[model samples]
Target chain A: MFGLRYLEDVVTLELDASKCTGCGNCIEVCPHAVFEIFEKKARIVDRDACMECGACAMNCAPGALSVDSGVGCASAVITGAVRGTEPTCGCSEDADCC
Target chain B: MNESTRNTGECCQGSSTQKPVEQAREQQECTCQPEEAPHWSDGSIDTPSGRILRVKTTLTPRDHLGTWMVHWGIRRMRYKITPGLYAVGSPTQQSPVFVTANYKMSFDRLRSQLWGRHAWILVLDTKGVNVWCSAGKGTFGSEELMRRIQAVRLEEIVSHRTLILPQLSATGVSAHIVRKGNGWRVVFGPVRSEDLPRYLDAGMKATPQMRCVRFTLANRLVLIPLECVEWFKYLVLASVVFLLLSGFGTGGYSLERIQDVGLRSVLMLLIAYLAGAAFSPALLPWIPGRAFSVKGAWIGLAAVVVLIAYGLPGPGVFDNWLEAGGWLLLVPAISSFLAMNFTGASTYTSLSGVRREMRVAVPSQITATAAGIVVWVVGRFM
Candidate 1:
């Protein structure tokens, strides 16, 4: 999965290693290989790879992971700003706005 | 293959004559016929549930064509596989059941990687979107998952009580609720479908590498075609408007006047498009700014320098230093606005970050462009 590796470091993904249960959920849920387990705890191996999708944090039962995740598109954010609503990519579960 | 099975497979094929959307609609209607239960083709064996089409794990020519069309933003809404249970190879009651979106590209990516393996694919209707995007929209949420499971009578078809879902879909699905409601365990798989084979082989355990998402240069490049195509109409309109406006400055509508100012303005616009939409994305990683608008402005500035060096727009196009400065400001501002559109496709941006960027960038872009136009008009007429 080669991507714009340099730009991804801007993602605000943070891992509270102290709260990790070492169940490896974050390691499994992250698509960017952002975390690695070391010494029975999860570590941020490649911080630059995080897409800020927040899959790891959602799957983490121990609440060891957190990130400010939402639609990342500029147009969506602008639309939200103009419309005065939470920014959405329009791919809501009930309607196919694509 | 049985007649019903063959017809079902034909429904999945790209129609040569009909519009893609019409064809998809017809296919969707076709699948609804109670007698024509969906089935697989290519040496697939018949099962009690339906025909399990034995399919190769690699992409076919049709699949390649579909991917190419999608890249160009052609009939993208029509590019979906019918939502239902599909079998890859010779799946049985004990085979693993994987859930995904009905977006044809996503389905192709998953099935293509599973060559020589047997599995049951349960595709949920996400209105032709891929899993990750649909998940964010909630189409690939727990409710849909549970609905598909029941609709397919999944409990009866597969003996196993576990369902494998993409890790990216976790945001929309509550694993606890699904387990509590259905007595089935939800196992989140790796981020990429390419890792499915390895994940399955390793007893459903994803390695650290498999979980990470990678947006390589190739991924960024593929998004460019669609961006250019979608924005092309606007680009053409902008060029025409600028050309007309350029003719209004100084001289009346004359062949010489049109050629000198009109053509030059249009040329500048084309350069803006190329710099903002195409070059900015291709040179994404190497660009100097974390913000996409800044990167686009840099590219636009570079283009302006080259244009001035070559004197391509003609010396009369800008009569004074103020007019020249106005062109410089306008070019990069247009470029910046266009480049900002890529934030949706980018891998690193977050909602908060994008909001913050837009709060500042959009206003600045609007002001720069407005001021540049005012300066140019003043320099030309006054």
Candidate 2:
């Protein structure tokens, strides 16, 4: 959350304005302040700030938001790579990754 | 100075009169209790499914204590409430049903904000984790929600066909599945519990500011204590090794040599820890790099500068500048590595970005630390 922004173009966040109902659900759920409503449609105002938590996408009732979201922890990714499984955030009962 | 004293100092602080482990055990026992007797107010009501425990919407001293204990990494895993239905006020069969994690803090925050409102809180079993984390782990997913709904017989308790879930829990829950399975519509609430009032008043619609996640200075600062506590063991091990190794440079171990080396090494390790783990997260935005490793390295460099300005461990102990130079490289490297670990807890980092940063940063850190160790060893023998 520190203001140190990473690669500007790497986030997977996408919004379909045509399908958006201008409900502002995406704006209400995004912790990064990534969306803004203009002309009754949700627009990605700060795309680079997105951490890809997927809250905005899930709250989009009209199916207007989408993103590839997963745990950002490095250790968990490495563990998943070694074990040959999809990376988890290490909160599951089977994995003690954290 | 010794193990017992060090442990006492580390484990006990102001207001933390009880031992952490004991508190943790107590918390576990509290959660593990049978659900037959609910921990609610005297005005609890018995419904067709089960008893709905009426609870105060305001936070008590015990709640504050629990929150503080969690912040300090005490009883964190056991800080949960029993999963079931709870009542905030005198709600009838038609009141709104809100879903949340059983983590006491999440439950407390939600209930406390609903001071005068009558609502039904559907607590999902999250194994003591908050809503966001539990959602990411799938513990707060569709299956759990469905199970809890059936267990609580929510349909029989309320007349509504809608369930309000926190927006962050979207990752683990598929609204389509829930709707199709139970015929109950899911309404995603705001990112924060405080915004629930406005959301409810506006016909369950959210505003722009309610969705945004802000990691302000205070939020960043709260995370430092837990990080410091978690890394304290590694810090101790590193300090001991550095202290013992510092004596090798002077040919033999002497009281004065041991004391000097121990003090300086411990000071350097402390500086490295504070720079990387504590200060890095606290001053994250101001640090002049996009990469966390680079940000940590800058802070480590600042620590090195401070040490150098204070006179780099007098030449009387070491043979030459080689040992000093080694420390100059090693301390910052340690700081950088610890700072990189913060990427997991941070809000801005993405999985792809963390992967990319690790590819470049990890190797450089390994090389720098290894090279520093080699230089120190060679200087010792010389």
Candidate 3:
């Protein structure tokens, strides 16, 4: 989105436990004091602070890290759809682009 | 260059934007430069001198021809790439660092304003896609930024550790983690890059009102011509299909004058395209209701009025009206579908909010479009 929201849920880093394999990859990767190990699994100490990028998922061995990822830009989808191209959004071409 | 090496942030390279409404009322006159370059192509200087400092850029014949052409083809009917970076003039390290994609349109909007600013620009490798879409795909997120930071040696360019980002990009970059991992603090910028000057002058802080995204009529309207361009080919194809189908529906009489039907079909399509892709974005905010569909409907209605004024014809036109109405319904639904998609482009709205809107909006569109088709087919005969 590259657009900023003033309400300070500014950034957060979390792992979905149901999918997590208790891999410590995120803890190893993060530079901020955002994540900590708990019960052999990594947890987001500050969920409201997530920035919404997909780094953990990239390095996570088990593919357990999943966040509602994607740059939420409206123009991108409209641009994709207007071309008769399938939208690059979570929904189908006929669906909302975001 | 290479696909894997695309994360270098070579194309765009920037960060978050500042909100507009908040800046207008702030009353703080910034000592920065006073005239930002025009937002986009009016054939003016690429960069302006306003408090907004546009990122410097140079386009050679070499960048990405195929990719640019493809993107151009895609946007022929709608959508655009505002390439370049910008700053509200005289920017310093204290100016927030914003990031965006190299879609050209996005890049230009970000940097073309800062003539002599010193803010860090971090362009992610969306492979030519813009920010929000790229973020959704994960190309504009943390891994890419970190890699770009490493690749570009961003630390060497700026003294500040804070990297402001477009709010829509949050899905890709986890803030807390970036600070821990890259030693760079992530700040969500603004929804529109034009607001950068006002934002920088206001102590680098965004008010709650600034963060809200409104897809006003002006917002929706500007997108129309671009949308029409994006779908030009589709419109041609649709015209051929409609002409052939209407002839078939008539069984014989209208068969000989295939040219007439073809022209009419194409005209209908033009109207639809203008209404849906063109008019839709222009009339966004003023169209009515919070939902994009309603906004598009308003535009579609306006397109219908345009059709009436142009003399579409008599009962012979009822057949045209059916085509027209079908398009009216169909286009806005398409526009609404497209406009609703803008959520990813702005600072407001979250992933969950988007998902929620889609859940409700999609089913409604599906049903409406299906009905429109049915009525259209029925009208062709009766």
Candidate 4:
């Protein structure tokens, strides 16, 4: 991230600490280093830095993590709003995304 | 470099003990046709699994050119390799299997980084998307990985059962499921293929730097081409609309007025576009705002200053103060909206953050643009 920060408190990423077995899978998969193991439990240390990529949730075996993840591009949002669909980069069927 | 490596090349050349008919049969067994060999692969290698294509560790001139073209958004979506298994150098049954997307750029980067090393390259069909993106869309998920593994008969080919996938691919792939499906342990490698050599040398362990993704100045700048290209069609339409609008004036629909004011408006818009798409991104970190729209509007404000200075009375660029005021609002609005669009290319933006920004930014942009156009029209009539 090298001094590049997005909007704070806007990411939907959340962790249910009671369910965390602290297998360190979230630390392994997160690109932003958003989670860290604290006393055998996963802690959201840098919550603001989370991009909500959902890698943690997917890899979390105990179902401790969850987030509303999707492509964060503006054009995708605009296109989805116009077309009445979920925000997509339009890379798959439409073939017009970056 | 060694005798075994030389033997691999010779065997692939069909100069060894294997018969021509047998070679043909092996080639036919692969998912890809012999004649349709991807530009990157040199020839096919006969393996216990099947006939897998052999790729060189170095990238060719054509590969470099193709990557450059894709950066400019030319044939980007179709720039893909035939998805299946491939061999780099003379990989043996014990060599590690590296998983990647079918996108040529992704394959090329992973292979080229292997320079002088041997590994099995298992390409997943992500419809030409890079690993991170396809993973986000679920093309690189557990189901696809399990399917590709079975299709290639990977268990029979490799002595080990570990699959080395790019760390970013974890977004879609659940390691536990892949383990549960067939006991093929999934090992997530470094975020970048550039770090492969170190990761491999360190016994498949990744340092913190290898896991974290960074968006330095170079990363931000390289995405500018696609961003600019995406706006091309819109630019043309906006220019035509402004041209038609410029024909209206106190003199009553003069073509001469259109040539003067229309050309100026187009130039202003062009500057605004570059300011938002290129300049703002280059200076993104230094820009004093968390929201992309605010950062873009600041740059747009700077553009307004430059345009006004250039449109001094002797230059005769603007007819009156009202026209200049309209431009001041219009230029920043366009720049702000365009800059907000860059969230897709950025590495660390969240969906919630983008949605929150759009809720406020989009409405403000529309209002500013509409007000600017109305005021400009009123000024023209006066």
Candidate 5:
């Protein structure tokens, strides 16, 4: 992550502090260490590092996390836009989806 | 239909005799081997659950070849192993059961790391996709894990209810749900299979470094082949089209002009492709942009400058200024689009970030390409 940072302030990740049970699931699920426990509440420490994979939101029992999660591939976005479907890693036989 | 086939059809038809259907399903799930392929495993072992396939800790020459071939997008989608339980070494009831996707690359990487160790590999049906991508698509979700566990009767085969899953699979698997619903605790493993030995020896606790994903130079380099392969056909087609188009001129169709100018255009395109797909990714960190398109454009511009200095398009061009001007805009646009495609392979790019970049970059690239083409065609006529 030191040299691989992407666009700043573009991640859709948001945390409703009141909904956090301080379960630390977000911290556990995040591959980027985007979350931290502060005063028994989940806080987004490195907001820009969040890839919005939806793992933290899915694993969070209290539903404290929310983000418009999807594959971060430009080709997928282009294909999905053309096909009028949700962004998908190309699943065609010839293309290695993802 | 045969007895098993008819019984399966009846099961799907909601037949009243459901017990046989359940038994048939269990029987199939237990022996997950395909009828035509026996090479899925190295050998077989007798276990309490059934006769489980035994896999080797070391990969074969064929496996290495297959890995290399897949990098070039050859037979990549079909590269899969049978999804079920496999034995590595001589695993016992107390042995660790690691779960993974059915992609042969994923399976091979995991098993190869387990040399001289006894372990049980529980392969999930992900339609040949790797763990991280399949997990992102829900193919490696909690339902699939629970279903596989029930189908294989894992409770009977293992003495423990713990499962070790790759940390990246957390995108689809809800550890809390797996534990709460079926009592099988999911312990997420390291982000890479190579770190598995250290993870197990540390009593299954992963350090922060193990959890984080890094796009190292080697990782970035390995993906370059696929990018080249993906664009190679298009590059050829575009070159041919430009060659034929170059024959048109104010005097008449001239083969000599086409040979000189069109051939030069092909070389420029190839250089642009390499700059975008090869150089841009290899020099990603040093490239001065958060957006991949911008990074590619910078490299493309540099490549174009080198070409111009080296006297591209030759001296006999209908108009040297027009031809060079068109190439200046065209090469960078082509490079930028190809570079943007790497967002899928990158580890840190968010969906929002990619979308934001594409929104601005794509339209600009399209405009540049259209303008460059117009200018280039005008130069050919002059």
Candidate 6:
């Protein structure tokens, strides 16, 4: 496993120890090695390694976990929002936008 | 477009969408697949390291250089060119030098647009990824740009200290840092290559529109496929599950009612995806709010309104009710998900902005989807 300090990108999750339940879910669910468990509570051992996928926070039961997670590609999000349908590729079966 | 030929051509090809590792894997497949580009003596480039780089593509007429039709065709089909640095023409001292990435399509685009222009293309080793993704990954950042400049000995090839970079690459590569590190100036050009000539002719000033990022309907529409493709697997599984459950609840283990699951899912999925990815982008300014999730939610509600008016049969129509229920939650949840995806795309969103949005939006999304699914089940049982 990459050391928790391996943050290659900015992360959204930060543990407010005052708020954390020490459930250790953030450390468990993080795809990036962004957190570590210390004192039965999760700590952000590496923020830069966080891709901000939000899995940890979503899986967090006590709401102690948080992140600004989502797909980062602008085009994908834009296309998805407008069509009221999944965004289609330029070659997606000849719809008007496609 | 025969299946085999398409397969051969496709594998031999590259995409900006693929990550570096994925691209590397695909590149390997290019040589291994049959009828792969036949430019080389057995249609493959076998490196000493046992890695395969499909360097050979079947020759095409000179209307464009070797195999560029495939390049252009892919660009047109996808509406997205691979990002990277490339060479349009060999340049010596006093010749213009352009920088890009190994995103084959982006390389092809810059060169193809240059047409008859003679320029040196400095291909930065973004590990064969496109310029934008490379930028996000820091491959297009100061260190990599500086490193690539050094590796290419670009200073030797051009008398000018200026290297033209794509406008979108500005986020990761700090121009000041690049200049300080490499003794070269970074000049950002237009977002599209066709504007390169105008940009250069105008002494490297990007027109207002060129600098502005557009989320036109066309742009949104083109990106829909990648979204759909990803959901394709989940879609299949979801539909199967929904159908089986619906059958048990409504028709006692039947296929006729099962197809409705697919239809409902397709419709709901499409509405939400389009609202978030396509409609939101196209109507961003008028989406009623600054927050992407809120904007997506607005669009999602509008979708519900539109579909309710257009597709629903009657008050008690069960299928219509299921669809409506499906969309009520699906649309908002999808919009939330799509909006969340926007964190990486927009220039304005900060880590805090994104984090705050997620804290509120995720639970709402889950609640909405759960509620909609429950409604569908209740309606079916009723």
lDDT per residue (tens digit) for residues A1-98 in model 6: 11112113445666677777786545533434457778977788767555554545544556676666443444333454566644211122111111
Query: Which is the leading candidate under DockQ?
Result: 4
For candidate 6, the per-residue lDDT at B125 reads 47
Q: What lDDT tens digits, residue by residue, belong to model 2 across residues B38-66?
A: 34343687788766678888887878988
lDDT of 5 by residue, A30-64 (tens): 89999889999999999998887888887888888
Which has the higher lDDT value, candidate number 1 or candidate number 4?
A: 4
Worst 10 residues of 1 chain A by lDDT: A89-98
Sort every candidate by lDDT, greatest first.
4, 5, 2, 1, 6, 3
Model 3 chain B: weakest 10-residue lDDT segment is B1-10
lDDT string for model 3 (B214-272, tens) is: 54545544444445555677777877777776664555547654566556656766666
Model 3 DockQ class: incorrect
Q: How many steric overlaps are in each model, in order?
A: 19, 4, 115, 0, 0, 46
**Per-residue lDDT of B6 in model 6:** 13
Question: Which candidate ranks first by lDDT, i.e. highest?
Answer: 4
Clashes of 3: 115
* lDDT of each candidate versus the true structure: 0.72, 0.75, 0.52, 0.83, 0.82, 0.55
Which portions of model 3 miss their true places by more than 4 Å?
A1-87, A90-98, B1-100, B154-160, B166-168, B201-203, B207-218, B248-262, B288-290, B294-316, B319-382
Q: lDDT score, residue A77, model 1?
A: 71
lDDT of 4 by residue, A26-66 (tens): 99999999988899999999999999889999999999999
Q: Once superposed on the true structure, which residue ranges of model 2 sit more than 4 Å away at CA?
A: A1-4, A14-28, A36-43, A56-66, A78-85, A92-98, B1-31, B34-43, B312-320
lDDT of 6 by residue, B13-132 (tens): 557576645554444333222444322212222222232222212222442442343332333332222222233433346667777765555665666566556566665545444565
Root-mean-square deviation of every model? 7.7, 8.3, 13.3, 8.4, 5.7, 14.5
Candidate 4 DockQ score? Answer: 0.43
lDDT of 1: 0.72
Q: After superposition, how far is residue B192 of candidate 1 from its true place, in Å?
A: 2.7
Q: Which residues of candidate 1, in runs, are more than 4 Å off?
A: A1-20, A36-50, A62-66, A91-98, B1-40, B43-56, B202-205, B251-255, B311-320
Of the two candidates 3 and 6, the one with more favorable lDDT, higher being better, is 6
Give the range where candidate 2 chain B is weakest over 10 consecutive residues by summed lDDT: B1-10
